[model samples]
Target: MLSTPISLPTVFVGAAIIFLFALALYPSSLLRWFQRKRYQYEVTFSLYMLTPTEKFIFNSILFLFLAMVSIAVALYLPRHVRIIAHRAYYYVSGDLVKNGTTSAVLGTTAEILTPTTVAEAIGSA
Candidate 1:
């Protein structure tokens, strides 16, 4: 009989890793696509509710949650590895945010104002 080089576990592990990587990179693309699809014609709102720091924190939290759940499911259901991998990828990369343009504007504004604050006046002015 011919020798089988790759085992099922190895394949599953590789798929899981790829899924996680995709998830990590999905946020920005997914968010942008979602906004374009759903609110393409609508007037954009302000990002007054969340700062860039808050946005990053929120995205990180979401990514962590997805990673945890994906890992848990993958560990518990080895046979359904493919399904778990797909779900994890989708969840991780899926767009959870709606208005990215507003956030961009807010971030830009913050950047612009940050250097003009009174704290910088002592040295520059």
Candidate 2:
């Protein structure tokens, strides 16, 4: 049996649901995982052992770096991923052969059988 193709939005929504479920059910485990994973490398220079002013500056820099990375992935990566996935689906499904068009455009379904013969319709106000 042929499987139905999942849309990009469906994939994202399903992922978000799983993420939320994990957060709700396993909050302590997630925290433990973070604590276990962190500080794996030997601290040549320790952030935790810094003076108050130095700690604040180090935290500020770290926060900025995290924010930049998050924003870059959130803003740009989805659209890029979707375009690539759609192209891959096109090749895999042979949608061009079956549908005789690429992905559906967001508009009316009425077919344009012929080009309209245009008369000069602009009137001086």
Candidate 3:
């Protein structure tokens, strides 16, 4: 008996389908983790009351620092295959596009346009 070898495209699509399935099923847990990591400092700060000026200054500094750190990490982090795999899983399986949650959360025309820019560039030009 002989079995046919799976073509690369089929394998890739299959992997994407499986990843999406996982994301759909377990997105809450993934989201919880992402929220914890992303807003941990904000959660900590919520315990204190802040005057308007203090709030503005604190948030401005915190966000600036976060932006810088995020950029630095994006540039310096090791490009690991597993990270790519997980992100691929999230993008394919996550309800980001189908449910339109990402756009709703981003709440800006520019944010909405950004994904289209990437997709169009990658798909057609």
Which one wins on TM-score?
A: 2
Give each model a TM-score.
0.28, 0.40, 0.28
Q: Per-residue lDDT for 57-91 in model 3, tens only?
A: 98889889999999988876755554565567657
RMSD of each: 26.8, 20.0, 26.4
For model 2, residues 10-47, the per-residue Cα lDDT tens digits are: 99999999998988777787687776655542154475
The lDDT values for all models are: 0.59, 0.62, 0.66
Q: Estimate the TM-score for candidate 3.
A: 0.28
Structure candidate 1, residue pairs in collision: none
lDDT of 1 by residue, 1-125 (tens): 74978889999999999988987777678778886764543333333356878767866897799999999887877746655665566477542122233224333333333334433543553
Candidate achieving the largest lDDT: 3
**Pairs that collide, model 3:** 20-93
Clashing pairs in 2: none
Q: Where does candidate 2 stray beyond 4 Å?
A: 1-45, 97-125
